[model samples]
Each structure stands twice: as C-alpha cells, then as structure tokens.
Target: MAQLRYQSRRFWGGLVGVALVLGGSGCQPQQTSTETSPSPTASPQPGQTDPEPPVANPELAVYWVAYKDQEQLVLEPTKLPLDNLENATSEEQLVVAFKRLLEGPANTDKTNAIPEKTQLNSLKLQEDGIRIDLSREFTTGGGTKSMQARLGQVVYTASSLNPKEAIWISIDGEPLEVLSGDGLIVSQPMTRKEFDDNFSL
Candidate 1:
C-alpha cells in the first residue's frame, strides 16, 4: 500500500480546526486552529482527568434542521470543552463540533455561493473510517457546479481531520448515488489525492 499523508483545517470562531463537516442535522460547531501537526497536549483543569479528556456530555447535541436565506443542520444542547475551542480530539466530540459549526457560519462560503449551514444527522465509526450521514439541506439552492463545490468543501474539510478513505454521503440518512454529478457514491474508498482533488483541499 502507498503511504500518504493528507491534512485539512476547518474554520470556526475565526480559527481553523481538524475535520470540519459542512452540513448535517446535529453536528458540532467550531473554529480552526493553525497547526500543521496536532500535538497531544493536556486539557487544563476540568477538561483533565487522570487518564484523558472528559467524555462529552450525554444528549449534549440535539437534532435540528434549518432553512431560509441560509440552510442549516442544527444541533441543540451543544456540549464541548470551553477552553480550547478548536481541534476536537475524540470521535464523539468531533461529531458535536460538526453540528455546531454547521448551524453556525463555520463552513459558510458566501464567495463561492454555497450555503454556509450544515448539521450532523448520524456519524458512526466503521472499521478504519468514520461514516458521516448528512441531511437534504446540504444540497440546497445552487447550480450543479455550485453544489459540487460545496460538496467538495464538506468532504475535504471533514476528511482532512479524520483522514478516512471511505466516505459515505447520505441524503436524509440514505446514501446518495452521485453527489453533484461526481461519482461520489457511498461505500467507496477515497485516496488522499482523490479526496483533495475532488474537494479542492
């Protein structure tokens, strides 16, 4: 197998973060942190346990869908650590951060004309990759090219943090046959180059 390394950063609260999801129903919100390499540092005080960072609060994020000038995947009752807002380290926390950013303006690219809001409907860790399910609002209000750019933004942004080969994008919990006319179907393993090229990372 060829060994390759790919990196990405998603902006939240004016900072870049690891793996930023573009749209969904209940994902977490965040800013990006500017670090090519992530160093495992101790989370201070309350965030610190003897072993590791505290687990995410239960039901901390709720599912919501938003539409209007800007569509959204909303997550109510968002829960995450307060001090270091960028770079969520765990899978559960990453999920929550995605939801929050989707609802907020993390991935909203007005210059590119992609609706800035997204949410996390469902996320599961399957094998070596993370399965992220998205809502219909993700593909709203745009031409084919516009939507494609947006999809690229979402895919590369999230995959940058997770670095998973297989990405299954679903519409309202069902897999999409083709995203923006690209052969971006579910259950296919994406190489780092494929992901970066397709999503413009």
Candidate 2:
C-alpha cells in the first residue's frame, strides 16, 4: 500500500511538470516574422507656411501736366514704382501708366487735367493711336486756357507711352470734337506735336 501511494504521487508530479513546460512553449515569441516598422517622413512645423518666391518692382515714367510760371502748361515726368510692369504686356503697361495719371498729382507744383469727378471710362490701344474715354464731367468746367492745359495733359501723358503717336479723346463714348470752357474744335486724333506747337511752355 505504501509503494502504491509513493508511485501515484510521483506520477502526478511528472504530469504537472509536463503541463507547465507545454504552456511556457506556447507563450514564447515567434521568430518566423522578419517584417520591420517603416520610418516616419518629414512634416512641416506647426503654424508654419511654405515660403513664397521673390518678386521685383519695376520703374516707369508717368507724365503730369502742371503750370510752370502760372502761365504756361508744362509736361512733368513722374517716376512710378510699377510693381508688375516687368511682367505686363505693352497694352497693360500703357493702362498702368494711364491709371497712374488718374491718381492725381503727388507734386504740389503740378496740376491734373480732368475734373476731380472725371472717371476713366475706357482705355484702348489701337493701331492708329491710344483712344481714351473719360466721363462727361471731364468737359464740365474750366476756361479756354484751362481746357487747353487739360488737353495738353492728356496728349503729353499718353505720348510718354508711344512718344510719336496720336491720342483720340472721347467723352462718355462719343468722339470729342468740341472742348469745354472754349469752343475750340479738336481734331479726331490729337498729336503730341500739336500740343508741343500750341501749348508747350
């Protein structure tokens, strides 16, 4: 009976040892996987934006008409910092210069041609010349002397772009044949030479 009891205890002890070994082997990490985690890519910093390419500003000349001795109207060259002049087309450059003329004068010695209320209705570059259309207010007031000065202003300002071409002036959309303040009959296309011959100081 003593031997049988000792034999049973030994058999139970061996079974318990085998079960523990099998459980431990099942829990061990596998060596068949050879895959590795991928590395992370670079990202922009928080709240930061990409830098923009550099741009350049170009210099352009805008013509302004003003009285020299309070008697004669003279053409004054105003330098403009045209930011997009380099990349602009020929017509676009002319438009920019014309727009600058409409900005009024920065020089206290210089004066503008069109009335303060006058608006630039349209601007077009034609094969013949540059046609400029202004609001009807452009012909509202001013004496003959003022009208001539204003006319000279438009001629000279536009001439800076073409230098040797003519400029056709229009009021609202119709050709301007008669000027205000004076009943001067203006030709269809006014040339810089005409302004130089009659109005230059």
Candidate 3:
C-alpha cells in the first residue's frame, strides 16, 4: 500500500509539473510581425477637372486705308487678334503685323494701299530705327496718289510700336529713292510724323 501511495504521488507531481510548464510557456508574450502592406493610392473623382487654358490679350494694331467719301480717303487702324501671336517675340509680332497689313482690310469700304503681289523680303529692328525690305512688286503699278497712300500705309504700320522711330524702306535689296513713274521721291529713314507733315493720301 505504501508503495502504491508513493507511486501515486509521483504520478500526480509529474502531471502537475507538465501542466505548469505548458501554462508558464503560454503566459509569455507572443511575437508579432513588424511588416505591413502598403495602402492603395486615391483616384480622382469623376467631376474633378484640371486647370484652364490661358486667355489671349489684344495689343497689336494694323493700319488700313478707308474711304471717307468719294473725294476723301483716310488711314485707319485695325486691331490684330493676339491669339495668332502665341509665344512670339517683339520682332515676330512686328512681322505678323506687317503681314496682316499686306493682307488688306476685311471691310468692303476699307482698302489696303500695299500692292497685292508685293512680298515681304526681310525686316530688321535696329537700335536707331527699323528696316523693311520688300519685293520689286512694291514699286510697281501706282499713280502719284497711290504711291503716297502706300507710303503712308507702310510708315504708319511700321511705327505702330513706336511712332517716334524712323523707318528705312528698301525694294528688292536696294534703298528706295524714287517711287514710280509719277516721280514721288521718298526720303530714307522716314518717321510717321515726317510722313504726316510732308504728304497727304
């Protein structure tokens, strides 16, 4: 009997020791993972929009001839659209203004003094004044009045940026001294004020 009791106590103590070992291990803190998944990027809403485009400002003007009456004609200025000059330089703007002037007026009552076939050869902006070179057609087919009117047109249009500055006119590659068979003499490096003071259209 004594032997049986000893064996029973040993069994119970062994069982309790095993149970304590398991319970102690379970009581320790658990190891957690440190890595985490990245969150998804947010998408734009359906009604959302981007920025708007830039708006153009009208600043340039081109000169055209307008008939006041059967007996009278005048020089008139028309504003050119700025949308055509997207990111253009000062020289480029001047070139475009000249081209627009050469294209003639849109109104039926208004007219362009520049000849239809005349072409722009080159234009140079200098420190003292501006230089404009045109095709030989510029000097062709015009009476005294026509020559005066065309000269006024060119002077006004070239000086649109600075009326005080002088302009040197050239035909083909040479300087224009005599205009046409009508014998209209043109002084080189002319200014708008000078043209206004000396000639009439």
Per-candidate TM-score against the hidden true structure: 0.44, 0.64, 0.68
Worst 10 residues of 1 by lDDT: 1-10
Candidate number with the higher TM-score (2 or 3)? 3
lDDT of 1: 0.50
Q: What is candidate 3's lDDT per residue for 108-178, written digit by digit as tens? A: 87888789999999888888798999999898886888888989888888877777779999998999998
Q: Compare the candidates by lDDT and give the number of the best one.
A: 3
In the range 1-201, model 2's lDDT, one tens digit per residue, is: 999999999999999998999879986787787766644443446896756569543335676677677876777878656575767776677677777777888878887866788878888888998899988888878778768777877776676656777899999999999887457778879898876666534
The per-candidate count of clashes, in order, stands at 30, 0, 0
| Best-to-worst ranking by TM-score | 3, 2, 1
Candidate 1, residue 124: lDDT:
69
- lDDT score at residue 127, model 2, on the 0-100 scale: 92
For all candidates in order, the CA lDDT equals 0.50, 0.76, 0.84
RMSD of each: 31.2, 19.0, 17.7
**Candidate 2 — which residues are off by over 4 angstroms?**
1-60, 69-71
Model 2 residue 29 lDDT score: 83
